[model samples]
Target chain A: MVNLAVKIKDLELKNPVMTASGTSGFGEELADFYDVDKLGAILLKGTTLRNRDGNPYPRMAETASGMLNAVGLQNKGIDYFIENIYPRIKDYNTPLIVNVNGSTIEEYIEVTQRVNELDKIPAIELNISCPNVKEGGMLFGTSCASAETVTREVRKAYSKTLIVKLSPNVTDIAEIARAVESEGADSVSLVNTFLGMAIDAEKRIPLLSTITGGLSGPAIKPIALRMVWQVSRAVKIPVIGMGGIMNATDAIEFFLAGATAIQVGTAIFRDPFTPLQIIDGLEDYLNRHQIDDICKLVGALKY
Target chain B: MPSNRIRMKKNVGEFTIVSNSALNNTNYHICLQSDIGLPDIAPGQFTNVDIPNNKDIFLRRPFSFFDVDYEKKTVSLLVKILGRGSKSLTELKVGSKLNLVYPLGRGFTIPDKNDKVLAVGGGSGVAPILQLAKTAGSSPGQMHIAIGARSAEDHISIADYLQFAQFYFTTEDGSLGEKGFVTDHPIFHDLTQYNRIYACGPLPMMKAIAARAKEAEIFCEVSLENLMACGFGVCLCCIEPTVKGNLCVCTDGPVFNIKDLKW
Candidate 1:
């Protein structure tokens, strides 16, 4: 059997196929269609210190091969997550990574501190790159200074593996990646949703409630791969790559491009079983290539 | 809620076009019948129809289960050709094979016996309201339907409602019964007359009806047409913020009580 285990700092993923946050709701939602334990990891939806109502109606707008969402990071806050969601999902076999979003530096530390107390929660992904919310989402992620500050503060409060999620809507993504890594981030996930918008030509109005929204799907795959490649080369820490991963072939491309693990985001919306299918596909790919260890594929790109 | 995902069972149904009438300058109503056994589809539930012309519209366009004939295994649809995805749906031939994902979305709740129900619909939203009227019609004469459109031509023929209950129509251009909005119609002026209210349509229209029903403290439910990729709730795109928190519109409801919705 091909060894599929890959390590990201202290934590080890069964495979490189993990569900991206926001796309997969707490991992329990997809359990009906596919076995949740089959996935390498489940990145739960973005959680905040307080409950957020999110934006108004028409939060999603469909494009040619993709979709734009301005969901505004609506969640039941961190406390309810610990009390209601965690206890249930903790029973699942897959590693659980809580995606934390904060409006302020202190909020980030507070949520990370709470997550550090949970025994079942293996890691915390500090989401500094959400484009939909009005406050502190992509704001902290765009600038290197804010990104490092948030990562460093959370690193101080919590001892678990800290993954700083970076936004694609930046001048130099490598600068931000380096900033997070220098601030003691365990690893980094790159290429959060790209900012996009759609219009109803007839109505002469924007489709989403929020005029501009975060775009995700096959449309952004190439750009995501480029960012993942650049950031992987720039940082010493492991990189988790995600964008428009639809199948195993796409997952292999990310691994070849230097991602330690890959997250399936938009594809899950189309087929809930995609991540599991990807895991199985990766196994077949490794067996065919005669690669004994999957970790060898990390940053294997030749000059 | 337990994951409702199950192995998709394919069922083919044959349907004939009874009438293809132009509802407005742009929209058309293409009604059809099927020989195969049809599943139980509730109001607010929709069918994903595959269109032949455009390959880009890979996913089926979701249409509300406008009307159903169980004995004949037939279904009717009010198709408004708003885009290329919908325009392709209107061009189907009389004996065409239409692949459909039937009975998707949570339907409206049926009112208890002896309860007076007021059903409101606007634009293409009239489909489910009519279906609810048919479902509620078995009670003799307890169902009331109020439909609104921009003009008289925008209103689809509702001959099926003759046997159900009272029917009210409103058009903005004053071509039909009342020359105003559905809320402005004389029938809806007295919200206390109905024991329960059900509405679906444009967000603003549903919100207006919901507000009126709430002020009267009447039990009211609304079906939201949130943008959805997978009608099975996997997308997390069709989420509606409700009193119960964020719930999937495809699974938790296309149908939700007005009280539950934060709007």
Candidate 2:
């Protein structure tokens, strides 16, 4: 039998498929459709230090083979999640990871400290790559120094597995990945949505409220794969890859490119069962290839 | 007091198009039959339909259940051709398969047997308003429906609902029942007779009705068509600012009581 299990720091995942942050809201929406615990992990919506109302109307724009969103991390803050949301989701068998975001370094540290107290949550995906927000999101991720600084500060406050989610808007994503690794990040997830924009030619108006939003879906798969390969080679920590992973074939490509695990993002908006379908597909693929362990596929890409 | 409504479990089902026909110049009525049996759906709850074989339109379009037949396991949507995505939906061949997430969001509150309701609709908003009226199960005198469009050609014939409701029409060009908006109709002059008011349409139109309903101190709700990505709570793209901060239009409601709204 092929083993689908993988590890990042002390956290052990049953499988390598996870729902991308900001796509599955606390795992409640997809739970109604199927059992969410079957997947490797559930990355809850991006939670901030304070409640954010997010961008104005028209926060999304659909493009060819993909979509753009400027949701701006609209969560009810860390306190509400602890008191209201955490209690309900704490009992899930799957590892529930929080995608933590902040506009300031102290906010990031404070949020991390609070989440460290939650026994059920095994990890937090540090989000410094959100393109929709004006202040600290992409600003910290685009530069190597700031990425290293924020990782260092948050690392001191939290006591569990920390996966830093990187932005693709940079010229050298591998350099940024190395910078986060130097600061004590247990793992790194690559290629958060690319910074892109869409326009309505006839109306002479930008489609998204923020003018430019983070783009995700099939259109981003190739670039995300390239980044995952580059970052995986650059860092010693396990790399969790995600960008437009719609099916098992798409996910297999990431594993071959050096991703220990992958997350399903925009595809969930299209089909809620995508992650489950992928998990089944992975098993079938391994059996067909005569591979005993799924980890054998990671970084197995030939020149 | 705020309404205590329990959130219902949503379903993702594959349905086949049973019929696709035009209701007006701009609107088309497409009926889809579910491969599985129908779930417990309410009046204002909507469905997110995946437009097949179209690369340009990547996201699924959301529409309220225009009509649903449990016996036939079919749900209908009244689609207005706003863009390439919607226009493509109207042209789908019969028997084509479409995947959908159904019974999403909170629907309108079904009125008590003694309550009389006035249902107002404009543009694509006509779909949910019709569903609300059909589900009300009230006599002709107990239910009133007001529909407004730009011109006579924009209005769809609701002769089918004549047995269930006292219908009223208002077109901007004065080609239909009355000249101005639905609020200008004769029914607006006597809203005290209605114990409940429900609207689903353009922002200005619903706000006008909500204002009138507030003056009469009647319980009123309106369904909002905010721009959304995932037709579930996760996306947070379709949020409407209410008394309780920001609430997702896809989950907390596509339908919400007027008192909860800042407007």
Candidate 3:
């Protein structure tokens, strides 16, 4: 039998497949389609310290092979999440990981400290890489020093598996990964959406309300894979790769590129069943390749 | 008012195209048969339909449920050719397969048995307004529907609606009914007559109707058509600012009471 189980620090994942934060929305939406308990982990949507109105209407624009979004972490703050959302999702059989975000270091630390009290939530994916927000998000992730500093501060507040999600809108993602690793991050997830813009030629107006938003989908897989490969080699912690993973083959490519586990993001917008399909496909791939454990495929890319 | 049962679960499965008939140059009536049994779908609720075989269109397009048949396990949609996604959907064959995340969002609150109602619609928004009229189970003289379009040809046929409610129409070019917008019609001027007002159309038209309804102290609800990514609450792309703060148009509503809106 192919053992699909994997681990990140002390947190155990039943499979390498997981739903990316901001895409899954606390794993409630996908529960309508299939049992989310079958997946490795569920990353809740980006939660902030305070309720954010986010941007105005026209937040999404469809592009070639992908789409752009300027949602800007529009959550009801950590209090509402802890009171309303957390209680509902906390009991899901899979490990529930909160994708925590903030506009300031104090906000991030405070949000992290609050989540630390939730016993059901085994980990928190620190999001310093959101491109759509006007402040703090991508600003902290793009630089090595700030990435290290935020990771360092959040680390002190929370005592759990800390996965620092890195932004691709950087010159050296590998260096940023190492910086977070030095600050005591348990693991790192790579290639949060790349910054991009869309326009309407005839109307002479930008498509998205923000003018520019984060680009994600199949259009970004190759670049994300390369970053995952580079970061996985640079850090001792596990690398959760994600960007444009539509199906299992795309996920297998990430495993070959060095991702210990992978997250399905924008693809979930197209097909809600994609993460489950990927889990099944991974097992099929293992059976075909005569591999016993799925972990063997991680970083198996040959020169 | 018909108390809509809040259906917590949603489905994602393939539906085969039963038929695709053009109502006009810009609009098409497409019916889809579900592989799984049809769930109870309410008016103002929508579906995120996948536009397959089109590499250029990546995201699923959201459309309000125009008609649903439980016996046949089918749902029909009123698709207006707005962009590449809707245009691609109109070109699909009868046997084509479409995946959908369906019966999403809270629907309009059906009027009370004795309450008089008025529903206004235009463009892509006409779908749900028509559905609300047909299914409200109102007696004669209780339900009135007004539809507006830029020109005569832009308006789809509502011959099937005569049995359910009284119909009113207005065109910009004055080709079909009264001239100018639906608000220009006499039905909109007398807002006190309607116990509840429901609108689904362009923002300007709904806002105008909402203003009149508010002045007359009538309860009013309007369905919004926002650019959506995921048809569920997760994306938070389709948001409408209300008294409760920024609520997802996909979840908190594609349908909202005018009073709750900041507008």
Candidate 4:
């Protein structure tokens, strides 16, 4: 039998497959399609200290093999999530990780501090890297100093497993990964959608109201994999790799490239059953390769 | 209005195309037959049709539920060539099997038997309105459909609707039944006579209808179209900011009442 278990700091996942934040909202939509509890984990939507209405309409546009979105963390505050959303999803067997975000260091710290008290939530994925929002998202991620400072301050408040998701917009993602490691992040996930824009040439208007939005899907896979490889080697903590992972073959490539666990983002939109399919395929791959443990496949690249 | 028993569930199935024909320069009608029996699909509900021929469009293109023959297990769609994804779909031949995620989003409320209703449509938005005319169980006192296009050549024949509704037509050029837009047509001017209004069209047209419906104190529900990835609520990109909060157009509604809408 093939074992697909993996760990990041003190947290242990049943497998190395998870759904990315914002892509899978509270893990409820697909309840009719599949049993979401079967997956490794579910990263909830990005929540702020207060309510966020998000951006204006025309916030999304389709591209070749990908899409662009500027849905600026449009969730009812953490309180609404706890009162309305939490009780519903709390009973699922898998861990529910809250994706905490804000416009300032204090907001991030405060949100995480509150989430740390929720027993059902095993981890908080600190999102100092959302590109769609106007302020304090990618601003903290692109710069090593700011990234380190935010991680350091938030570390003081949150006691649970804290995974800092990194942005690929940085010049040297490895440097930013190293900085977060120094500030005591349990694990790091990369790469959130790359900043991109599309314009209707004839109409002379931008596709998204935000003008520039975060691009996700297969179009950004190669870049995400390269960054994940670099950051994985640079940091001691596990690196959660994502970007354009459509199926199992794509995810296995991430494991070979050193993503201890991989998150499925844009692919979820295409098929709600993809994550479960990947988990089954991952086991099939292990059986074919005669690898008894899935963890052995992590960073399995030959020198 | 239907009772609270409305549990709008969706299904994923493969459908075989029986015919594909152009209705106008931008619009086409494709008929599909599902081998297994079909489910109960309401007007304003939609199907996410997969364009397998195009490598670029990895996502499915959503079209409002055009018509469905439950006995024959055949469903139809009114597709308009809008972008690369839809352009590829219109080029597909008959007998091509397309994957469909069906009966998605909530449908429009069925009106009461004694109510006078105005159903407005524009461009490719005529499909769902036609379905409502055919299937809205309540036999309303009177129903009128006003469909608009750019020119007389752009207007498709809707003779099938004659039995269910008294229909009107308009074109930008004075070649069809009327000269101006649907709102400029006579039915909209007599909005006070109608008890309810249902519309689906371009954003500007629906917004204008919503404004008039509000002024006339008529109940209004508009089916919205947005750039959608998942026809379900997983991806929040299809959000419409309403009075309640940010609601996903895919699940909470492709159909929403005007009072609940922020527009």
Candidate 4 clashes between residue pairs 3 or more apart in a chain or in different chains: none
Candidate order (lDDT): 2, 3, 4, 1
- For model 1 chain A, give the 10-residue run with minimal summed lDDT: A27-36
Quantify all predictions' global Cα lDDT against the true fold: 0.83, 0.91, 0.90, 0.88
TM-score per candidate: 0.82, 0.96, 0.97, 0.94
User: Roughly what TM-score does model 2 have, to 2 decimal places?
Assistant: 0.96
Count backbone clashes in candidate 2.
Answer: 0
Best by lDDT: 2
**What are the DockQ scores of the candidates, in order?**
0.25, 0.55, 0.59, 0.45
Model 3, which residues run further than 4 Å from truth?
A: B1-8
TM-score of chain A of each: 0.98, 0.99, 0.99, 0.99
Where is model 3 chain A poorest over a 10-residue stretch in terms of lDDT? Answer: A26-35
User: Least accurate stretch of 10 residues (summed lDDT) in model 3 chain B?
Assistant: B1-10
**Model 4, B30-126: lDDT tens per residue?**
9999877777989999988778878877788899989999988899999888888788878888888998887789999987677788999999899
How well is each residue in B92-186 modelled by candidate 2, as lDDT tens digits? 99999888887799999998778888999999898888877788777678888999999999998787788778889999999998999877899
lDDT tens per residue, model 3, A188-252 = 99889999999999999999888999999999999999999999899899999998999999999
Give per-residue lDDT, candidate 1, residue B205: 90
lDDT of 3: 0.90
Error of 3 at A287 (Å): 0.8
Tens-digit per-residue lDDT, B139-245, candidate 1: 33687888899998788877767777678899999999899988899987787878999998888899999888889999999988777776665555678878887
Clashing pairs in 3: B1-B112
